[model samples]
Target: MVKTGISYSSLGSPDGTLPAPQEVARHAEQSGLDSLWASDHLATGAPFLESTVALAAAAGSTTRLEVGFGVLQLALRRLSWAAKQIGSLHALAPGRLHLGVGLGGVPADEWQAAGVPVAERARRTDAALRALPSLLTGRTTELPDLPGASVTLAPAVPVPPVWIGGGSPAALRRAATLGDGWLPAAITPEGVAEGLATLAELSGAAGRPVPRVTVTVFAALDGHLGGLSQDALVDVLHGQFGFPRELADAVAVSGPPELIAERIAAYAAAGAEHVVVCPIGGAWELQIELLGKARGLIA
Candidate 1:
C-alpha cells in the first residue's frame, strides 16, 4: 500500500543532541514510518556527515523501512563510480534503496573545486541515469579508452527505484520518461496540478507507465517542536532557502488543525502518490507524531 514518511536531513534537530544515525533510524522505523530518506548534502552537516554513510548506518539499524537519497546530485558524480557505490549499497540494503536524483545546479566554484564542470553537469547526469541501471545490473559497458576497462557493479540486487527531482519543464519530462517517480520539493497545490499534466504528456510520448509522484514538502504543525515559534519557523524557511517571507509563509502551514488537514488533502488531490513531510521547527519525534497524526497516517 502507499504510505507516509519523513525525510530527515540529519540525525539531530536544530537545537541540540542527536542519537546515532542507527538509533534514529530504528526509532523512525519503530514509529511506523514506511521509509527513511536522507538528503545527500556533503557540506550541510556542521561536524562531519555524508549521506550514503549515514544511510548505510540506517540500513544496519532496521530490518524493514525503505531508505533513499532524498536527493543526490547525479550531475556531479562520475556515472561509473556512482553506479558502483550505489550498487554496493543496494546489495547491502536489498530491496530498500530508492535512488533520488537531482541537478541542484550548484555553484560553479564548488563543482570546480570538486573536479567537475558545471556546464557539463546536466548532460553527464542524463547519461548517468541511462547508464546506471545497465551498469549496476552486471553488464560491462565501455567507459572510454583503456579498452576492456569495464567494471561490473557489486551485484544485481533489487533494482533501486529511481526518482527524479527538480521543478523545471525538462525535469518534469525526464521524470515521466526516464524515472520511476518524480520527487519535487517545496511545491504548491497549483504547481503540482500543472506539473502533472506535463508529466502525462511526457509519459505518453515516452510510452512508459504513468509515473509515480512523491514530494519533499516543508511542513510544520501547531506549537513548538523544539523551541521555535510558528513565526520563527517561517523565518527559518525564508532564511535557509532565500525564499521571500510572504511566499514562504503562504506555504508554511500553521494555525488551526482543520486548515492543516485540508492542506494535506489538497496535496493528495494534487497528484502526490507519497508525500514526505519536512517539519521545519520541531523535535524529531514530536514532528513525527504531529505530522503522522495530522495526515492520518502512521510514521
Candidate 2:
C-alpha cells in the first residue's frame, strides 16, 4: 500500500489563524497518517514558520509520524549552517526526517534578501546535495567552489533521505543522480507515469537505482463536507502557486472522500510510493480526518 501524509501548512485556518505545530502534529499522528510535512519559506508575504523549527516541533510531538520538508530551498542559507540544522534535527528525531530540496523560484525578493542570485539556485542546491550526506554523517566534506576547504561537523547523525522536489526535467536529473527520493507537487497521474519512466532512463544512465516517488497533491474535500469550492482550489493553484490552469485542474483532487481516494489510487497506479495531501480548504483537522479515510480506501 502507498503511504499517506499531510502538509502542516494547511493547518493555517481559513480565518487566518495558525494552529500550534505540536497540536497539528499530534492530530496527524492520532489520525494514523504516515507522515507530516511542513513548507519552507523565508518570505512569501504571508505569515509562516521557519521550516526546520516547524518540523522540529512536529517531530518532538509525535512518536511514530515521520516529519519532513515538502521542499526546502537550500540556496538561501549557508551550506554548513543548513547541514548543522539538519544534523541536529536528525539527532533529535533520528530516523523520521525526510529532507526535500528544491530550487525556489517564486518571490525572487527572498532570494535577493538572502544574497543569492536567483540564477544560482539550481547550482547551489545541487552542490549542497552532493556534500550534505558527508556533512551530516560527521565526515569531512569538501565545500563547493572552495578549493581544498572542507568542514567536519560534530555530534553527527545519519543523513535523512533527501527527496528532490520539482516537476521540471532538471529536477528529475537531480533526483536520478543525488536524491534518495523524488517529490513533485501538483502533478497529474499521467505526469507521474511519464516522469517515472524518465527517471528510470535517467537513473539507468547514472548507474543508480531509481529513487522512490512521492506526490504532493492539493485537495479540498468540500463536496460533502462543504468548504472551499473546486474552482477556488484551482485558482489557488494557478494564480497563487503558479501552476498552469490545465495542470492545476488535472492535479487538484476535490469533492467527496470517495473522489479523493480515487485520485490517490490513480497516483498509486502511476507508481507513486507515497502521497502527501495538502488540503486547500475545510477545517484543517476535519480535512485531515477525511484524508485519512481516503488513504484507507487507497488499496
Candidate 3:
C-alpha cells in the first residue's frame, strides 16, 4: 500500500501560527497518518522550530507514527554534531526515525550563521553521509577534514534510512549513490516517473539498488476543510519557490478531499511509494484530519 504522511512543521497557516509539535503529532497518529515530517532550517526568516527538537517531541508523543526530517541541512552543523544528534534520536525513536538529508534551500545567511560556506554544502553533505554509517553504529570514525580526530556515539542504533531531497541532477546522483530513498518536492507525476527511471539507471551504474521514492506535495483543502484557495497555493509555489506559473498550477494540489486523493494517486501511479502532504493553510488540525480521509480513499 502507498504510505501517506503529513508535514507538521509548516508555517503556511493563514495566521502564520502552528500548534505544538506534540499536539500535531498525536493528532496525526490518531488521524491515521503513517508518518510525520518536519523540515529543517537554521534561519527561515519566520517562526520555525528546530527539526531535531520537533521530531524528538513528536516521537516521544506517539509510538506508531514514523517521524522524519523532510530534509535536514546536514552541512549546517559539524559532522560530529550531526551524527550525535542523529544517533541520539535513533536511540530515542529506534526504528521510527527516517533521516532525510539535503544541502538545504534556505537563505545563504543561515549557512553563514552556521559558519558553513554556501559552496561547500554539497561536499560537506556528501562527506557527512559517508561518515554517518560508522558513527551511528558505534564504530570509530575519523572526523571529516580532521584526519586524526575521531568519535564514536554510544547506545548505538541502526542508521535510519536516509532520503536525499531535491530534484536537481546532482540530487539524483546523490540519491542514486548514497541514499536509501529520493525525496522531491513540488514536482508533477510525470517528473516522478522520469526521476524513478533515472534513479534505476544511476543506481545500476553505481552497483546499488534503486532508491525508494517519496514526493512532498504542497497543498490546501478547500471549503471548510482548510481555508486556502487554489490560486493562493499556486501563487505561493510560483512566487516563493520560483516555479514557473504554469508548472505551479499543474503541480499544486488543492480543493476537496476527492481531488486531493486523485492527485495523490497520480503520484503513486508515477512511481512514488509515499506522499508527504504539507498542507498550505490554516485550520491545521482539520486539514490533517481531511488528509487522513484522502489517504483512506487511496488505500
Q: Quick one: best TM-score, which candidate?
A: 3
* Candidate 1 residue lDDT tens string, 1-299: 33566776643655556547787678778767767787765343354356688788888879997788888787666667777778877888888888999887476555876677777777777777877777888887764322456676656655688899988888898898779988888788778888888888889888998677787767666554344566776788898788788777766676443555566677778887776766665567766656556555312
Ranking by TM-score: 3, 2, 1
For residue 112, give model 2's deviation from the true position in Å.
Answer: 1.5
If both were scored by TM-score, which would come out higher, candidate 1 or candidate 3? 3
Candidate number of the best lDDT: 3
What is the TM-score of each predicted model, taking all chains together? 0.87, 0.95, 0.96
Error in Å for residue 104 of model 1: 2.1
List the candidate 1 regions with Cα displacement exceeding 4 Å: 15-19, 45-48, 144-149, 222-229, 255-262, 295-299
The residue pairs that clash in candidate 2, if any, are none
> Tens digits of per-residue lDDT for model 2 on 81-122?
889989988888889999999986658779878988888888
TM-score of 3: 0.96
Candidate 3: segments with Cα more than 4 A from true spot: 223-226
Q: In candidate 3, what residue range of length 10 has the lowest lDDT sum?
A: 220-229
Q: Could you give me the TM-score of model 2 versus the true structure?
A: 0.95
List the candidate 2 regions with Cα displacement exceeding 4 Å.
Answer: 145-149
Residue 179 of model 3 has an lDDT of 98
With a 3 Å backbone cut-off (N, CA, C), the pairs that clash in candidate 3 are none
